[model samples]
Target: MSTSPPAGPTPEEMRDMLRAMTLIRRFEERASEEYMAGRIGGFLHLAIGEEAAIVGTVSALRPDDPLTSTYREHGQALARGTDPRAIMAELLGRATGICGGRGGSMHLMDRERSFYGGYGIVGGSVPLALGLAWASHYRGDDRVSVTMFGEGAANQGVVSECFNMAGLWDLPIVFLILNNQYGMGTPVERAAAVEDFYPRATAYDIESWKVDGMDVLAVRAAISEAARLAREERRPACVELLAYRYKGHSMSDPDTVRDAAEKERWKARDPLVTFERVLLGEGIMDASAIAQMQAEVDQVVDDATEFAKGSPEVPVDQLADQVYAQPWNDDPRGSALVNP
Candidate 1:
């Protein structure tokens, strides 16, 4: 007995994508509430309206694929199938977190799931993704590496350099630019010389295309094509997902709120709503099924929140643990090794 998907995604696949996107939306909304209530610390970025791009892109990748991402990674984490409870606990800096609470929200590293670090620095993960792809190529593993960054990081010179190398070596890496219009406080139009980020890959002779990030199926199809070019053709490429962020760059940006008209314009194409309408219109799922899906997602998110709330915080004595390769023990040798 063999199991392989048909030519393209099926009805069930679309439904699954919808479920994942909805899950991320609910999780982020709850996370925002938790952040306001003082349950989470440090910088917090939400992908409230960019769920489709995240879920669709991740679903396009294979199980063995490795992914590196920017600080706006809560949605990516869920899309990659990281336990929502563990992710919440990590945000709370609990001892039982995915990275033992040291990584916090921005550094959700799950080795088992092959989701690498959620890099805090803009454009920092690009070269790392290239390296991962190169390593996989060297080992003949045939796995791809996907590096996702915001439009702000696209301007970094290091990203261009990485682009050159990825194309030159024909590494199997897909550079995904999540263009939410505004990069932090500055709009991308004012920041980058080239607004057509996808075609910019042509400068390095890499295949590229722009994707309507508001549509999950379109985004998934674009990424699936990119992955095919990498897997079968042994090439590298780029994709610019044109979506909008529903929240400020971070929770601390009080002045980052956008004008109501602009906000409503983007919200009009809300990925979650559009996907629901498509499914209902096609008769793939009835209204009751969609409602049931929403109810199930709410329960999952509620359970995750309750789990994180009751989880234990990292102990004071273990604060210095995992800072070095060796454990922080009372022994002099361990102390010297860590210090040295």
Candidate 2:
């Protein structure tokens, strides 16, 4: 989908978007470096090319709105106002991390920012987000819940189930499908019956739209409209943002499955570059301002890395903590201790 040209964002907003995108880019780049250096453990999914989808959708959300995202969620959490240092620390599994070193890269959480979590399982958070929206509605709150997942997850039966429940309950929720073309090594065409995901939401009688994910402004406008509809009219909405991931599905995949020319084609439409061109062309920002924004983002990422490096790891003996609620000793008869 092509983006419609509006009057263009104010210089300040444009600059903010630039800073956010650059921060995400630099953060992911540093994360890759850290992962390779053995500083970060576990799966690391970098949203190198989908910055617009994260930054733009997050910019449209209310401060009190809750967010549930897939594993590729560093950008979303940062855009939702999670502290960069804390997020970096979480990636490093530090005791001072967001989840206190328990939930690493795939499980960052910050309830204070209304960021629910970064779920590892595909489509696992869809129902959770719906339940959050239901809670908000039951409390007579206007806050909405935004659930983000990749196109690969669109086929999950859980997603459709959540959509049905949200529609039936008239919940204030936005299901954002970040269609980045490929689901790991398999492309969307190979998995989804219909590549146009927005239309799939119509089966549940929800309002839906598709936007150009490479254009931050377009994504922001579409999501803003969707959020407004959900809040004011008590309607559920879905949006499919057409985007592409420059890196492999995870750090492990070399992205060899797709053609080299296709990768180059998507790279040419990199969200950061596309947005910068629009801003500069519209006279909202110039090269100097962009350079400054890049520098600021670089410093933020560098500081986050240093913070992660210095943060302490969880104690080895406490590794099993929080796996399940602490086992209760329900022996009311005062039975003697037994180590069977």
Candidate 3:
């Protein structure tokens, strides 16, 4: 998808974008360090090089707007205003975590900030986001529901169904596609028919746009426009952000499938570095200011790591507590109603 009428962001907005990207970068770096130290359990996916897409799309949304994302969602949760400490705690599976030690790295949820739980199943959250948009529409609210997923999810049948319904109903939904070059070990060319995932929206008669995910300003502009269309025009739009992940599909993989030269090329375009350069070029932030910002973010992540480490683990007896919503019939008052 494409749009015109481009304008540069103000100095303050540029600085804020840089700060947000910095926080994400530092947080992920810390998470990696802690994971290696055996603090974080379960599978962990890091959004190392895709900082711009996460911060930019999130910066465009209203605070009350709901966001749903795939399993690689630490950046999404942080961008949606979940506390770093809480996210770190959740990753460590501590009792003070976001989901109270139940939903770990892949399933962080903070309903207070309108961040819906990150779905582990591929393409599962697409329809869930559609339902959220439907609810917003039915209640006559101007809220837009944004759903983030990888390029791999584009081929999922459920995604197409959600797209069809969102377009047909004119639902206020924005499908943010973070096309980070590779889906696990498979490249887009190998897994998908068309490399340009944005045009897939054309099949459903929805508006779409493609942006350079490495450029924070470009992502912000594209998402801002798409979100405005979704809210005011009650339309569904898709944004395809071309980016790459520096890490493997998960923390366990070595990410050695790609050529060393190709990895180096993408590393040179790191979103955090790109945004910092943009800020310096625009005179929005000096080297000292940037250093100070980095220091603050580093401190925050350090504190978060300490908090997660000090947090107590969930008791063994409560393992089955949150598995099901309703209380078990072990209570005598409810025994009489059992069919058996």
User: When superposed on Cα atoms, how far off is each prediction in RMSD?
Assistant: 4.1, 3.9, 3.0
lDDT tens per residue, model 3, 87-186: 9999999998999988899999999999997989988999999999999999999999999999999889989999899989999999999999788989
Off by over 4 Å in 3: 1-8, 325-340
Which candidate order results from sorting by lDDT in descending order? 3, 2, 1
TM match of model 1 to true structure: 0.94
Candidate 2 displacement at residue 9 in angstroms: 4.3
Q: Candidate 2: list runs displaced more than 4 Å.
A: 1-9, 327-340
Task: Tell me the tens digit of each residue's lDDT in model 2 across 182-248.
Answer: 8899988889888899988888999898989999998988888888878888899999999999999
TM-score, every prediction: 0.94, 0.93, 0.94
Alpha carbon RMSD to native, model 3: 3.0
Screening candidate 1 with a backbone cut-off below 3 angstroms (N, C-alpha, C), the clashing residue pairs are none
lDDT by residue for model 1 (16-79), tens = 9999999999999999899999989998888889998998899899967899999999888898
lDDT of each: 0.88, 0.88, 0.88
